[model samples]
Target: MPEPELRTDRLLLRRWRESDLEPWAAMNADPEVREHLGEPLTREQSDAVAALMRAEFEERGFGWWALEVRATGEFIGRAGLDEVDAGMPFAGVDVGWRLTRSAWGHGYATEAALSCLAFGFEVLGLPEIIATTTVGNVRSQAVMRRIGMTRDPADDFEDPSVPEGPLRRCVLYRIRRDAPPAARRAAGS
Candidate 1:
């Protein structure tokens, strides 16, 4: 089954299109946007990630859906669930997002992420979902909290994919089916 389109008051979360490639590459190339994610990617590397996302959607019916501003139809970035990377200690789906610099401070990540969580728990019947971010990525951590995830300091781990450094130390946050009522409401459940 194909992933169904998801919408919020101001955004549309849907599959990637060939037309999305250029902006996606530009976003990946921005050093500010890539700060916690590692070095800015070359266009080829960006394209490869997009290709992998498409393949994930094809194989699993969902991946990181390209995010768009509903009113202007602008491609902002992507937000959705993905399988936790193999090196992580956790086991289950993870929620994540990346947006263009212009799209920051707009609460779009929270809105879209709430929708993804709702789908993961309510639609897919997932028991839980987790999110991990570089310890320095406070903004993303705030978003996770806004959507009802709670972090356990004991569960923090160093990301093996990242070199031993400030960025390698990561924090894990999780939300389960029994999350708070406010959180469920945030997810539109």
Candidate 2:
């Protein structure tokens, strides 16, 4: 079967396009947008990543999808499920998302992520899905909770790859397939 595209009420999670490279590069170049993600990325780096994301889905049937506003076809960013990096201690599929500053505070991340979880569990037949981010990323943590993923302090750890800094201290959150849908979208995005 082909790599599948996912949709939320307002977002379309699909493969990347050449047209997205420019906006993707611009979004990555924004310091505010890259604040929690370390440093900004160059156009070439952005393009390379988009290429890799596209290739991964084609190769594995599941990978990052370029997130777009269904009404406008705007390439806001990316959201999907992928295996945790090899450097991490735990092993399993993980859900993640990155959106342009304009897209933040719009609940697009939570919508797309919830869609990803449904896909991981219902379609991919995954037993569980996890999400991790630096402890400082309360926005993302809120989204995780809003989507019903719970965090255990014990699951938090220092990222082996990141240098000694805030980004190094990461926290993990997870939701099992059998867990009840505990969706609780708090106010204020």
Candidate 3:
């Protein structure tokens, strides 16, 4: 099944397209965008990641959908629910987003993330959705907080995928389906 397109007032969350390659590669190559995401990727590595995203959509009907500005149809980034890797201490779907630097400062990340949370909790009937970021990535953690996820100090873990460094330490945040109405309201859903 194909992932369904999700729309917000200013953005569109949809499946990856062949045309997304060039800009996706450019975004991945940006050092600023790659700051907390590890080293800037070579074009080949970027393509491989894109391929994996596509496979996820094909297999599960949802993944990290490519984000675009609805008015201009410009590719901005990717955001949505993804299955946490089995090696992680926890197992479940997680919400995440990554946008080009130019797309920063807008509320796009929160908007798209809220939609993904809705899909996970409402549509998929998931009990909870989690998100994690390197401890140093305060910007992303802020997004998590804005989206109504609460972090537990005990849930923090060393990300095995990240090499031993400042980036290895991660903080986890979660929101359950039964979370207070205030939480969904805070996420602007």
Candidate 4:
């Protein structure tokens, strides 16, 4: 399936293209941007990731959409819904993002995420959506809350991929499709 394009007030979320290689590599190379995700991905690794995302779009009907500014056509970041991996605490739609440092402080993350969550629930007919992050990743967790996901402290667990370390423990947050309409509206549908 071709990856469908998604639009927000000021952003355009589309599939990756060859032109995005340079900036995408620069973004992944930033230590601060990769803090929660561990080490920076090398140029080769970044290229491989781009290829994988492209393949996922062709196979899964959806994956991480490349986020760009509608006005400037700049690749600000990414936000989209994907099926949760088996190891994740919850098995359902997963919403996430990674914006450039310059895009920080703006509400781009929340805005793009709200659209993806709505698409997952209302368009894809998903019953729920889940998001997870390292315990100290307050920024992402805040976005999850901003999108109406309630923290499931009971489901929090150590990420096996993180090894036995400070960042290993992670929290899971979830929002059911049948949640109150008011809360959904509060999440900015």
Candidate 5:
């Protein structure tokens, strides 16, 4: 059987498909979405990243998911858990998401994030998962907190990938395996 699809009340988190390329590319092209991620990606760059995610699913058993709205079956964005890049401060699982501006304020990012965290902590049996964002990305930080992750002010550091400047400063958050039930709760997530 194909790998199982994770469902939240209004969305599906599943493997990417060829049909997702256009929307995925569009999302990467948005200036607002790319604000924290660097400049907008060219179509080639976006496809290459999608190809890498496919490879990750095959090799790592899990990777970023193609997020679709259940009500409309429309491509919305992506969210999931994965290992931090080698240069990142944390060495283990990290949960994250990205959505188009049209999909903002609808809770889709939070919903998808909670589902991804559930998979990492409960399904993958990970001990902990960490997340980092540019210190000023208040929207993302809010989602991290809503999901019950705690800020480790000490873990904050300059992101190695970002050139030394304002954007390099990042804040880190984490939720442990032993986190309280409410903190790890994904049922209403």
Candidate 6:
């Protein structure tokens, strides 16, 4: 099946486009944006990622979608569900988002995340969805909390894939399909 498009009040989570390659590269290249994720990527690496995303979406019917602003038709970044990377300590469907530095502080990540969560739970019928990030990524952690995901200190682990360093420490946050509607309301619904 073709990957489905998900919409929020102000954002559209849709398939990646050829037009998105440039800004997506720019976002990936931004140091502040990549501060927690990893080294900012070169244009070639960024394009490779987009290609992988397209391949993943085709293979699984769900993967990162190019995030676009509905009002302005701008390609802001990407958000959606993906499988836990290989060699992670645990496994499950995970929700994720990344935005251009310019899109920071606007609630787009949370907005797109909530839609992805709804699709994962309500449509995909997943019992649980997780979000993980480097422990220092308080911004993403906050988005996890805002979307009603809870974290257990015990669930934290060293990411074997990241090598020994600050970036190796990771935190996992999760929300079950049955979490209260009131808890999920912080999506600004």
Q: Pick the candidate with the highest lDDT.
A: 1
Question: Residue-wise lDDT of candidate 2 within 73-106, one digit each (tens)?
Answer: 9999999999888978898999999999999999
Give the Å shift of residue 104 in candidate 5: 0.5
Reference-based TM-score of each model: 0.97, 0.94, 0.97, 0.95, 0.95, 0.96
lDDT of 5 by residue, 1-189 (tens): 255589989999998989999999999999999888888999999999999988887788888889999999999888887788897766888889999889999999989988888787678888888888999899999999988899978899988999987789999998887888788674232
Clashes within 3 Å, all models in order:
0, 0, 0, 0, 0, 0
Give one digit per residue, the lDDT tens place, for model 1 in 1-189.
Answer: 777899999999998999999999999999999999999999999999999999988899877999999999999999999998786777899999999999999999999999999889888889999999999999999999988889999999988888878899999999888877877775567
Query: Which candidate order results from sorting by lDDT in descending order?
Result: 1, 3, 6, 2, 5, 4
Clash-forming residue pairs, model 2? none
**Alpha carbon lDDT at 96, candidate 4:** 92
Would you give me the overall lDDT of model 1? 0.92
Pairs clashing in candidate 1? none
Off by over 4 Å in 5: 186-189
C-alpha lDDT score of every prediction, in listed order: 0.92, 0.87, 0.92, 0.85, 0.87, 0.91
The Cα error of candidate 6 at residue 106, in Å, is 0.8
Q: On residues 1-189, what C-alpha lDDT tens digit does candidate 6 reach at each position?
A: 888999889999999889999999999889999988889999999999999999999999999999999999999999999999888899999999999988999999999999998888888888899999999999999999989899999999998988788898999998887777776565332
Error of 6 at 177 (Å): 0.8
Q: What CA root-mean-square deviation does each model show from the true structure?
A: 1.0, 2.9, 0.9, 1.2, 1.6, 1.4
List clashing residue pairs in candidate 5: none
Show pairs that collide, candidate 3.
none
Candidate 4 deviant stretches above 4 angstroms: none
Give the true-structure RMSD of model 1.
1.0
lDDT of prediction 6: 0.91
